[model samples]
Target: MRLAIGLAAAAWAVIGSAASAQDYRPTFHPDQLKGPPAGAFNEVLVLGSPHLSDLPDSFRAEQLQPLLTRLEAWRPTAVAVENLSGLQCDFMRRYPSRYAESVEAFCYDPSAAGRALGMDVPTANAEVERLLEAWPKAPTAADRRRLAALFLAAGEPGSASVQWLRLPAAERVAGDSLTAEMAAALDRRMTRKNEVDLVAAVLAARLGHERLWAVDDHTADSATPPDEEEAQAKAIMAAWDNPYVQARKDADQRLYADLEHPDGVLNIYRDYNTPDTQMVVYRSDFGATHVEPSPQAFGRRYLGYWETRNLRMVANMRDVLGRYPGTRMLTIVGASHKGYYEAYLNQMHDVRLVSSDEVLR
Candidate 1:
């Protein structure tokens, strides 16, 4: 709302006519946005988090408590996590062949896991609270598997896998409907993936939220032919070997190191929300300008697909906000997508972004 085209024309004159006549540059001064309209401001905090579980050996679940505690204080009306919708997970479970990859990734087995837990979706999420409350000091293998079944029942197979992984191989046997195949499904889901949203789920439950929103969209990234995909990746990587990119990589390493300390988690969140971090996302990652035209065009196509996915995810979040006006919502997503999500969500008439720095403090 702060954008003044008339003022922008006057400002353009300062750049000098030597700057290409065809070049388009519209400056964005976000401070100019008139604060949200009267009444309760609908606040949104788009949190960019690394996949914590994927971190090195030093990163433990307990280390996340302080970060979650800080977030819990924000008192979000709703929490949105990066995951497929429960309906989609159900369809994947029923028709595995059609959605084999997704079904495998989610480790959803409605017939077995669903029956074992005895609930679905909103009703099923209650088990999450029960598991948290009744978590044993030194849980037996049976206890672990039971929790795993409960997570699957709650439509959180990723978290279920984390629980199942804690059991010893010999003790990870079939129990009731939890057969070896089901156990393997759980194991497969945990493979090479982090349960980032599990943190979001815990925070939501602590705040008395009924359920978390599944706003991630996979339908936008269509399959490019394998050869074309490989070539595109090669070209993009070649362009990415610059000083700006290297500096970001160095900073990322430092951030990853900070995840080890309990207090460091808050610092990590604060750093991620800074304008410097968000600007790099555009200048180096999405807005890098030196690739040849052909490769650049190919890269642009990939960026388009990425933007489409974020747009759909935002639309899903908007759906939740529409149902409950004046709600404060928190979206927990991968750090790389943070800029895109904020950019699209800021365009919405009613939504206003809450400063993550203030929230961390």
Candidate 2:
């Protein structure tokens, strides 16, 4: 009987070893694994993309191809987008007129600004130009009014004559001031516009899945700038006891320290919003709280508001998962979001995390 029991144990050990060996594949490709079951929605792929304007042709050929192959293999039911802000959605459904108003208000008026810049304005795209030429000779009254406001804001008069006017002394001074501010604002807007386009194109090409879900929360405001380094340090120190946050800080420090730039530390600092002044405070605070040495305090804080916002985002993703049941999802978001997203999603019983490196490569 004892001999029979020993043999049984040996058989179990051998089986375990074989299973482990089968699971451990050294290759980097996603094709190394089989797709999830047809009725099972168990996997998710998250990607990080540089702004639309920054994506080069090389990125499409090199990075995007592998990602496409993985998505095709997985055959997700839907592709989610980061666009579709609240304002955009509102315009889509209830407020069609307001939506049209907003679009006209937002776009740059080429005719007025082009003439002021001493350039002959070319028509817009063929479709737009064709519509404009065939139209009631002018834009709709609302569109015309909106364009006039935009033109005035851009330091070009909506009236053709005012566009060419040599401004009177006082008006010229005000115009100069407005022109400087408008140019700066325009530059910033243009930068963001290009980035958005780049991200959209890459996602569209790679996923090709219809029913794109826009999961972003438009209400969340931009991150506040840390007033000083020390303030930022204190915020980082505050999270020291949390193992996950500590691991992230350690990784960021090692990455930044290796850089040659004096401002290298600033990358981690800015990422965390840690001010230098708060560093000593965090150091002292963390030391008092623990007996052992700890990772360097990076001086960034994730406040209560940020935590709530992230929780909502996770809930949104879960809701989408529930609705689609078995469909794979690809989430593209900022790098700072990587930790929170992974932590929340990893806890779910049905979810499998696919690394960006696996997909991108």
Candidate 3:
């Protein structure tokens, strides 16, 4: 009788355990059962570049061709540059003085291009279409300059760069209504701050793309008071005193030495987008710990501004990129922004990253 009773209890316990197991439900919903279909995604290549043009001593214009060639083979459908969008253009046009600091720093010449082309942005763009439609099979240097001037007038520097490239090296010298400053600007496209951006524009025009996407955001950035700003900037730089900073400095020294090599330039970008390098950016630059008597209080504020700027910029990219599925896109941004962009963009359902390695190779 005792044995039978024990067996019955064991059976009851098993039955109760089974019932509980059956009643259990998962927290995950059916809607998240699978990711979007593989075909419904855009392949993004985030190329993180240093402001080489800013470091004039370390830049070489001739070294850019190999890099440009590799990027061109990727055949990106859209190229997003780190420039303020048309909205910012409209806002700045309305109140140029408000953004005088940016204008002065960036050397923005919106009207220069327009003035050179002899038409406004819209009219110049229409002329671009017209010229391209009846593009000459064997155009002369003058013809190319005319197209370039029109591209410049339309606020299309990238396309302008392309037209400049079409001219023979001898013809690229001067004259043809192209000013000295404008010539320098076009040459700078291959050397410095706008190098990748200009390359994108060139490739886009070559591929018959109408315009490059301007996706930079700055409205979220807050300016520090001029009097206190210098001290605060120093404090921020002081917080970044670590081996990593030294390591990067060492790397940059090497880069400067190899400025003449295209592979050398390309390597700088490759290493910059690496996961380890990005983590360092977060820890050393964006995530430095601060105490109450924080020397880096302004630094923290700057971090907030940087994040907000990137988030808004990513939103702008999505607005343009999400519409055209399966299109390969390249975002040429400051190296500091690469990690943040990847983190935010990876979460979107329809977007996927193409390893820069694949594209660069």
Candidate 4:
């Protein structure tokens, strides 16, 4: 085994040496440049979470209390989640052929309130900004309800949920241009148990934050041509059928099955954020896919798309931190994205990466 490992290392060294010989290789690193000497570093906590909607049926809202407590202790000044922005969805709506599916699956259509209030996504997005800028120190239920309606029209249910979750149950009903249908949708949204709703939005509301940022991006996802769809799926699935992936599945089943415990959700999160899980995820997913022997290079295509999506997501988070510099930001993303999020965000000059283990502990 040592002989095999030595041979692999030698081969990698040769490859690395050859790559180093290339004068075109970039010498500068972004992380090396940083900071206003006087200001606090922009701290970011990347929380890897399960898609709460996929949690076992036995799961309950109270199961999240401990996790919330830990995160609240961190006290993020800004919260971002893995959901596409309403404006992006609206832009994609113009080009259905490329983004129709992504829009349908991820974007909320706020046409009802949009029509009633004469606010399209762009218009409502602008209104949302205007309202928040002048948002009062102590906002009424009517204030929250109006903002919730604006969020809906902006195609941002995640942000809408921040407003929705803040309002008392009695104040959660329709009013202030939040039509009955949109109001009911917000009700359904708060109960959906998705990461954005149950976790990000809830935390944001508790922190007295007026809004949560939707930083997910699907701009790079293109529809696979009908003829090539099967080939792509076949190639990706072929890569996925590996031992590491199997082990991941087995562990997931055990974790989900154990959700009756008070700390079940936290345990699942710890499992996802563990250092060991990082290599497991890469080996099971991207690393495994990287070596697939597909004639169509479908695996690389899939990998490219994944990396691009994550990059854009990080860019969106950076955009938020740029707007509110030096503030701590909490980003709630999927388990698979934890490693990529850290790897990319670590390159930003002004950002300080916080350990998930530290926060989770």
Candidate 5:
């Protein structure tokens, strides 16, 4: 009788444990804690933007003025851009087999500027900080030119553009630390339609900021195995064929089509940041990958990369906020990264997520 009773009790315990496991929801929600009890709260605005380089030829650089005016009104104290730091790129340079293609493709080769200035990436990066630390109250055009050249040597053309734009039209010519070749290079950068140049750097310069922060990270990215390339591409593409992907594309097309409207471009940014956009986005991309049935589990591996990349990006953002509390940071990143950025950032105790709709308006 005793043996039979113990067995029945054990069966009930097993059943109860399984039931709880299936129904379990985490009770501790850090996102619910919206504020720090003391001191200034960190205000973060995550702006989702399409790759401006991909926009059609008809899109004018001046078209961004309206959007820029609105963001300027918000007066973000600092702006963080979606470009990898010179230091991170420098670190990745050591591992050629893993990062050769990524470095060649994504990272700017600052060697020429470095050679001209007699500064490697590290020394130039250090000089950038030292100069900024003792930055004068009223800097001359020469001061700006010197910093711009240092920024180029540091492999941060975006920040260099901020300094370039700050200069008077006449003072934009090569002199001081910025060599003639580098000046022409920056002239090219100033004309590029990409948001890093036309948007972030432009706005930062307009706001009187000396430099823009580079917070993008790519430590998670690696060279795809030659054999797995086809499998990986097929799995991700297959996942993207869902209705949500089509709907997202259609919605974006509708928004982009109306760029003639006063707020057409801004409206697209607002739409990308809505709360309802999260699951739709996930289903269209990462969630679909999660459900993909591949023997190689290529989908899961892709998902891991995506999550890890976003997590690291969020950490970089958080690190900035931690260093400088009470900052109104404008983080301009790619649209697909918006949902993940918000979800991860919300968990921080001091960070208060500002609605993009409010700022874009």
Candidate 6:
């Protein structure tokens, strides 16, 4: 009887060990790993609007709703957004001024303004607020308080408003000043532009799925012009006197051109001025250039940091896919990033790219 009991116990230990090992392995299915259907793609939607006005009035009902519907239909298992470190979100809620400044920097940035205008609204904050409000259950008061604190520290008053109203006026004011200084410092960094896209992308992705992947680098650097390139680009522009170039230059001076209305012109100019940092234009050789320029660049640079970032992002995406095995992914990005990201991601095995027009249609 003792011998039989010992043998049974040893067998149970072996079975338990096997179960534990299997449990650690991710159990995603191979059949579920397919991309979007032919002629349809899993999307990484990109936008250029920096403010509310940038989105069309139909965006919610037209663009976003349809996309959400499709995503639900497709049933992706994971979503990602560019969010602050968990600690940062906590910090924002605890500190209002920092949160406000961060929010301000995000919403009031040149790109943010462009996004708003693209959506035909005054600010992107409206859309975000709308999203939060529409959701039956959102973050708790505690969460808001934490986010507000971060916004205050970040120097974004508008962002702070979402949570800081609960705080005393004196505290709010002090926080605002500090947040502003922090935001200014961040503005000087090159990461701000890319960070916005990364954040928005992550947010939208999170709303779509439980498992969220953040695929962006968070490093910050000052914007220093490449001296040789700057000189060369200046020389090139100085020498250009083509009629087309001259015509464009002339058109720029007029608030509205004869062919376009004032509102239309404003929209275009605003979008052009706040081009996405990751936007790329492909040359014949497949070499890339920044397709959009910051307001400071006067529309000269067409491609910027997007190429490097996209490569890394795509790799991260692939890693997620590998881990999940068959899970579908929806990417959100700046409009300028849409074209290139689509082109490249489509080349990956078993991956698809969806267009905004197609999704909205």
**TM-score, one value per model:** 0.67, 0.38, 0.71, 0.92, 0.92, 0.37
In the range 1-361, model 6's lDDT, one tens digit per residue, is 9999999999999999999998886676543565554444433433322222343332221223323454455444555433332323333434544355443333333233223234322233344345445543445444444444343333232333424333333343323223444334432331223323323333333343212344432222113346556754554454342354444345434433321342442343234323232232222112322222234542233224445556655666666665555555655443344455555565566565444443333
Better of 2 and 4 by TM-score: 4
Which residue pairs collide, candidate 4?
A: none
lDDT of 1 by residue, 1-361 (tens): 3569867876888666657655856577553463666667678998888776656676666677777887888889888878876556665555644556656665344556666656775555676677667776777777777766766676766456556555666766678446677787765554443544347656754665535677887655444566787777777776666676877778878977777666766676677777788887666766763342563377677677778889999999988887778999989887778988888888777788887878777
Runs off by more than 4 Å, candidate 3: 1-40, 54-59, 96-98, 115-151, 166-194, 201-210, 258-262, 289-296
The lDDT for every candidate, in the order shown, is 0.70, 0.43, 0.71, 0.89, 0.89, 0.40
The window of 10 residues in a row where model 2 has the poorest summed lDDT is: 157-166
Compared with the true structure, what per-residue lDDT tens digits does model 2 show for residues 1-361? 9999999999999999999998997755433243554577457765543343333322222333333455456555555544433223333334443344443443333444434434332222232235334545333433333332233333222121121121222332223223444343433432243323233333443443212445554333333444545654555455454655555566555644543443332233233322232343334333334333324323222344345555666667777887667757766554445455666777665567776544433
TM-score of 6: 0.37
Each prediction's RMSD over C-alphas, in Å, is 9.5, 17.5, 10.4, 6.0, 3.0, 18.7
Question: Residue-wise lDDT of candidate 4 within 1-361, one digit each (tens)?
Answer: 9999999999999999888787465779887777653678889999988898888788898899989999999999999988888899999999999999988898877788789899778999999999888989989999999998888889888888899988988999998888889888888887887888888999999998888888999999899999999988999999999999988989999999888888999999989999898899999999978988899899898899999999999999999888887889999999899999999999999899999899888
Off by over 4 Å in 1: 1-39, 89-111, 114-198, 258-260, 289-292
**lDDT of model 4, residue 61:** 86
lDDT of 5 by residue, 246-295 (tens): 99988878888887787777777778777777678888999999988989
- Model 6: residues with Cα > 4 Å off, grouped in runs: 1-213, 217-306
State each candidate's clash count.
0, 18, 2, 0, 0, 83
Report model 1's TM-score to 2 decimal places. Answer: 0.67
- Point out the higher-scoring one by lDDT: 3 or 6: 3
Backbone clash pairs for candidate 1 read none
Which 10 consecutive residues of model 4 have the lowest summed lDDT? 30-39
